[model samples]
Target: MTGSPLLALPGAVVGEGLDAGVAAHYGNPMVEQRRLEQGRAFVDLSHRGVLTVTGPDRLTWLNSMASQALDRLAPGEGAEALFLDASGHVEHAVHFVDDGGRTWLVVERDEAAPLAAWLDRMRFMLRVEVADVTAEVAVVGVMADPSALPAPHAADAIVWHDPWSAASPRGYQYARDPQHPASAWNWTELVVPRAWLSELADAVRSGRAEVAGVLALEALRIAAWRPRFATEVDDKTLPHELDWLRSAVDLHKGCYRGQETVAKVMNLGRPPRRLVMLHLDGSDTVLPVAGDPVVGEKVRPEPAPGEATERRVVGRITSAAMHHELGPIALAVVKRAVPATIELIVESHGIDVAAAQVEIVPADAGAAVEVPRLPRLGVRP
Candidate 1:
């Protein structure tokens, strides 16, 4: 594992056995316990992006580049945005927040520099300055009452706040604000002095919160059906396919890199595959792993009471986790035409396992309602 100064903090423990591509940590037990109890926890999110947007045209430039309307992001408020390819596939996910006069962009760590470069190239005549602040800013995750803290303080040290009633997934940093507790909300980034992180950790440790590990976080995310960056989203995924239309894409926003494709998909019909939640058959001795084939209809008609042969290949599993509450919950991207409830099999470790009673929903059905599009930077197209 590469050495990161951020991970070297006292009482911080790195995730064991993970490869180089993944970076995760378990803060001191005390901090984790307090976070769990108060539903407020903080972790080192340095592995993610930290971008600084300065200069007069910062807001205008950002509003044009991302799928969200950035021009209207008032100080202490933040919005979720996406950097899409020409075809509207998400290249990177971003959290845009206003910090006093400057704007900060929190993105996936690996994408920070590339996105910065892309923005710089598009600066043609804009007066905005883009710089990668991944190394400078220490990103931490906080889940708590947003009303307790102001926006400026949130944005400075706490780079991201989701502010959703339900806890956000592992990679996502969200807070449950009193104002918009049920809805998906964003928060201002708060900057914590590096020297003070230890003190904060101590304070949290002394409390009742338990440090949550990646596995625990995964369980929380799976239950919510929140798609992750690399795991649930990738090159082949369209924003709409992953159920990201509600949060990542601003349909009413002006033209962006992939607006044409997004609009076409929306105006035309559903994508080939849609994201859905899976309820695995408990009797199956072996559990299905991700990437296992989702039997489609061609093999046979739907299972007819204890018939194992009535299965066909349809799609594949994207993510699966054994839930403490739900007992073996999974997320899969299956063919659009498949029945809402069907019996499928996932092959894990050379074992064929049955998946029963999958609850399928159209990727775009509930998300097509008209909402406020992020305000554009300049004039409308």
Candidate 2:
């Protein structure tokens, strides 16, 4: 399990083994403490994907394909964009940076090659070059003051900067990582050079900054109501229903594949369902896993003692985690008309749990007004 050179970290122990799919899960107290109190941390996002687009027509080619308006991006600027299918469903989400002549698309590892292939296939007459650079580039997460790090692409070439702070300094920039696209206003990302990995890791470990584990990281993400690829999205899920239209879809952008469906949904104003956050009551004993059914009507049997009843089929849990500050929390997808205050049962791992009450925060509650939009493709009654 610890055989991989990349897995060797001081005081770090690999659990579930490398063959288990997860590289490692940090249970270190120091790491957990850093995540809770500092409000900042660094994690190994090496599993992410990076692709480079070069040539004179890079910006025009990407703008025409993605939902965001990439044509206007200047060098050193980045944008959150999405690629959609005929139904306006997200095929991939990405963070794109325009470095004068070259554009880089950062995505999730699983979607990297496929997205590259899609981009290549779409390169009909455009004079652009697209290549997967995941091997040459490494993606890492940094949460703190942008001033602390030198300007990206400086002498060292720091090409990516996506800060999460609501009021990040003028020099700092934040962009969406299409791999883990979320509508939340609190999430931010940065693309650093692989050469700086040692220094960054040491800085985090030495207490100058915080180091976050997967569990604590997931907790923070849930509290922020951010959506991830595996937990919140899939082929069958429409981007609008997931509230992806706000950040990933550009209504005013030029023609692109699947623009019709995006326009239809925006004009119609109704998606099949909406995503919501749930507060669980009996989550203390048994926690609900992803894909667990969320009842809407009638009580479902409790998997344990002292659990609530009277549940109806409302939605399903997409992500769940226990936070040091917020206790147990979850994200669910429910029918748009479902009452936000309804109690429900979420069954996971053969355990039926009581979800105290659901809370539906407006999709754009605190989001930026200037955020992009996707045109309504159609009305779904």
**C-alpha RMSD by candidate, in order:** 8.8, 7.9
Estimate, for each residue in 281-373, the C-alpha lDDT of model 1 and write its tens digit.
Answer: 666656566678877444445667766654567778877766565777788887777776656667676766667634434532432335557
lDDT of candidate 2?
Answer: 0.62
Q: Candidate 2: lDDT of 282?
A: 51
For model 2, how does the per-residue alpha-carbon lDDT over 303-363 read when each residue is reduced to its tens digit? 4676565556777888887766566779888776776565667777777677765333343
The 10 consecutive residues of candidate 1 with the worst lDDT sum are 168-177
What's the TM-score of each model vs. the native? Answer: 0.74, 0.77
**Root mean square deviation (Cα) for candidate 2:** 7.9
Candidate 2 segments exceeding 4 Å error: 1-6, 10-25, 29-40, 146-186, 202-209, 299-312, 357-381
- Give, for candidate 2, the lowest lDDT window spanning 10 residues: 165-174
- Misplaced by over 4 Å in model 1 are 1-13, 16-40, 146-159, 163-197, 204-210, 281-290, 297-312, 356-381
Q: Please, what is the whole-model Cα lDDT of each candidate in the order they appear?
A: 0.60, 0.62
